[model samples]
Target: MNIKNTTSIFVDCHVFDSGFQGTRTYIQGLYSELIIKRDLHFFLVSSNPDNLASIFGNHSNVTYLKYKYENKYLRLLIDIPQIIKKHKIDFAHFQYTVSPFKRCRYIVTTHDILFINFPEYFSFFSKIINTFLYKQSAKWSEIRLTVSEFSKQKIHQHFGFSNYEITPNAIDNVFFEDYDKVLIKNEVAQKFSLKKYIIYVSRWEPRKNHQMVLKAFLDLELYKEYELLFLGNDTLSNPQYNEIFSQVDSEIKKKIFTLKNTDFNTMLLLLRGADASVYPSMAEGFGIPPLESVAAKIPTICSDKTAMSDFSFFEDYYFDPHNQIDFNDKLQKILKENLGTDFKIMAQKIKEKYSWKKSVEIVYRLIKQNQ
Candidate 1:
């Protein structure tokens, strides 16, 4: 096999330290696949190199670089450039956006321009800083890669550029693994005190549209038949959660429960055992939870905007993200319909359609072309 420009590729693995779930999953999947490729050398840089190294090490072509800084912005502006030049890297792939200055040709993954589109979701300081960095990376990177076609279009609309490629996110086969349904279901029910539950599995935040999900559940009176299981961090520190919680009556509040920092297998079991899975996010880059739910062979309802549409094929599975009436009707329909076979077929197609191996291959080829 002929490989073009056998130059070392530097990947910023700082995402591990940031505690962002979706970004970490994307980078970890790509990092795992890329390490196994034969024709390229990789420099994995992070403040927590030991953690990443334990996963991506044991390969002759992969080198681990560490930087000591507690602050993300300081590490990016100061530490990353110094490390890139010190290693003499030819191409650097930033898992998020790029540093303002560059020592080499670089590629950036603009996951989504959510801050630009929904500025209200972020604080004023965060919005100002992130918008500037995102625009710069989109404007100046050697190659811009986004997770979904929807994001590519949004980036173009926001940044006035269309020179980017869509690399798309994929589900790991771990989600598709066979498990003892009876045993796992019993365990999940006991742990969460759940009985006939419908699940929502994402970080609780405004952009996730948790308020709308709660409102719809309350309006439809689904709480009478099924409890709502929230399967992620409660994020109590976020003022949004407090505001939403204050509006709920104590009776309605008792029906909702949150389980934070769940183990991966347990989370999968919850999805598998759910009567139905609902993902009502207002925006997303690739919408992993809906895909995970579908992969678990659960009847899945998703917001009909952004990349959630790519995960669920049936029209009945989607509802307007902004409208509670649309969500309630769809949620009712999914529960009322016999859709198990339909969900299984869609899961098989989604599994085939999104592959980490294929996504990494595209990234590899792009890196070679730029090199």
Candidate 2:
């Protein structure tokens, strides 16, 4: 350690340029707090250094570095290791996988090992490769972390990684800000030409259960009054969603919209304008969208599967992702029954329970101990 009493750390920031996703959210939320501490020096590296700088403003303890190679292996093996040595980093934190050749004390947060538990959702090869890389990364790390108790348990059971702490995702305070919903909706309707709508914010993947959400929207005939908006980038092929859309009438099809890779501010505007939010993902490390919806004070119906079950505040709104009937009943009730009063009650609980400040502090403490 240096005489200055500061612990230098390197953070892999490649995920920031990959658009809005869970991992990006985790890193941005965690470090936005960690970088404020004068005792900790953070070297954040990415291909897009400008975007990193814009997100995280200047601080005395913070530094932004850029990646040389676009290739994953080269960046991991050559670029990062060299940076660690040059900067004299005391510790390095990686999202899921760490550099194979360690240059400093490594801290890895394998957000989840979902493939090990829900083998059907992931491909055979993906499962094999990720299991190997993630397991090895955990094994090499001096301290390990994950997003939820469910994820922590899965890691231990599958990879025998016992030295891990859960640093869960929390709803950002921006979502809870008091904004006039009618005005936001009116602006959204004018700008995007969107009418009364329900929202589902997740990438298009079979495991994310997009098809089921589409089916429920169609079956319930809610489109007559509300447009169904699927907001996210497509990652995997969902043949079922295609098949369902093909059979539906043109008017019914017109009522459903898919907005891809919109900026974060637009996402928030759309979320605020939503009549309701539906998150029916089959599995998750820690479900952020549902919590975000609750924070936005919108009536949300979420799946009670995997880590999402921890969001027990959505009790009446919870449904089985695999069961269409259960989802239908809950969805029907959430929309028909005005839940404004209920939202206030749920919002208080959500705010009180989870916080990015709390989550990030725990992670920082763990890293400082190991550093």
List TM-score per model, in order.
0.88, 0.97
Give per-model CA RMSD.
3.1, 1.7
Writing each residue's lDDT as its tens digit, candidate 2 over 1-371 gives: 24247889899999887757899889988889888777888899999988899989987788899999878889999999999999988899998899998879998988888888888878999999999999899889997889899998888888887778888887778988999988998999998889789999998888898888788888888887989999998788888788988899988988989999788899999999998899999989988888888889989999999999898888888999999999889988988898898888899999999888898888778876775
Report the number of the highest-TM-score candidate. Answer: 2
Over 1-371, each residue of candidate 1 has an lDDT whose tens digit, in order, gives 22234577888888665433787788878878887877787888777778787766677778887877758788878888888888787888885578776899988998888777777777788778877888887666887888998888888998887888888788878777776767777887787777678899988677888777677778888888888888877432546556777887898788888777765567777887788899888888888888888888888889988777665575668889888888888888888899978888888888888898988888888887886
- Candidate 2: where are CA atoms >4 Å away? 1-5
Residue 14 CA displacement from its true place in model 1, Å? 2.2
Positional deviation of residue 78's Cα in model 2 after best superposition, in angstroms: 1.8
lDDT of 1 at 323: 84
The models' CA-based lDDT, in order, is 0.80, 0.88
Q: How many clashing residue pairs appear in each of the predictions shown? A: 0, 0
